[model samples]
Every structure is written in C-alpha cells, then in structure tokens.
Target: MVASLVIGILFLVLGMALRYWINRRKFYRRSPIGAESFSSYEKSVGIKFIERVGKWIAYALIIFGLLSLWVYSREKNDNEKQTKAVESTR
Candidate 1:
C-alpha cells in the first residue's frame, strides 16, 4: 500500500511537471510583434512533435498515478478490515 502510494505521488509529480512545461511553452510562443503574427507563425516539426508526444505522456502518467492511488486505497481498506476482524475476535 505504501509503495503504491509513493509511486502514485511520484507519477503525479512527473505528470504535473510535464503539464507545466507544455503550458509554459505555449505561453512563450506568442509573437512579440502582435497577436496576428502568433496565429500566422507555423509550428516547426520539433515543436509539433513535442506538443503531441508530451501531451500523451502526461496523460499516461496521470492515469497511472490515479490507478496506483486507487489500488493503494483498496489495499489499505482491506488491511484495516482484516485487523479489525482479528481484534474483535480477541
């Protein structure tokens, strides 16, 4: 349970970092000349690649984190139930 929780937290943090990077890149992509130029500028192959792949990676990380947390919660509850049953029997 603890291991799962730790893994979940780590994945979540990594996902968050990637998300921040994506957003930061977008924010900085604006044209200094004018808003019109921002839309006119075409994305390079590398930037486009990162934008596409990074989004999927971030999504995967977040999903894995959530799944890990869910598993941790389920195990924790099961352990608690077993301990309670043992104590009651005594």
Candidate 2:
C-alpha cells in the first residue's frame, strides 16, 4: 500500500515534470533562433515518444495505487479468515 502510493506520487511528479518541460520548450520555441534540437521539437506534440510513454506510466502507477488498496483489503480479509479457522480448530 505504502509502496504503491509512493510510486504513484513519484509518477505524478514525473508527469508534472513533463508538463514543465513542455511549457519550457514552448517558451524557448517562441523564436526560430532558439537551439532546441530537431528530435526534441518533433516530440513537442508527443508524436514521437517519451511524453506519451510518461503519460501511460503515470496512469499505470495511479491505477496500481488503487489496486494496492484493494489488494490490502483482500489480504486482510483472507488473514482474518485463516486466523478464525485456526482458532476454531484449536
């Protein structure tokens, strides 16, 4: 649970970073004289890669965080059942 939340936060931060990078890139692209690389410019719209992948990763992490909570609940329930069964047997 904790791990997933941490991972989700980390992914969220990365997505935020991508947002910052995109805004900064746009800022720098205001003039043709800027030194932004060709490949970098090509990815401005997330057409090439990187940004899109980051988005997917962020989504996956968020989903994983939610799943982790469900997992914890199921695990707790199973544990309780096992304990009860053991107590009854004894």
Best by lDDT: 1
Candidate 2: regions farther than 4 A off:
1-43, 46-49
User: Candidate 1, TM-score vs. the true structure?
Assistant: 0.84
- Predict model 2's lDDT versus the native: 0.63
Candidate 1 residue spans exceeding 4 A from truth: 32-43
Per-residue lDDT of model 1, residues 1-90, tens digit only? 799999999998899899999977877776776332233235465676778899899989999999999999999999999999999999
Which 10 consecutive positions of candidate 2 have the poorest summed lDDT? Answer: 35-44
Write model 2 residue lDDT over 1-90, tens digit each, in one string. 456455656655665666667566556655667644455655655543665575566566556655665666776788899999999999
**Against the true structure, whose TM-score is highest?**
1
**Which pairs clash in the backbone of model 1?**
none
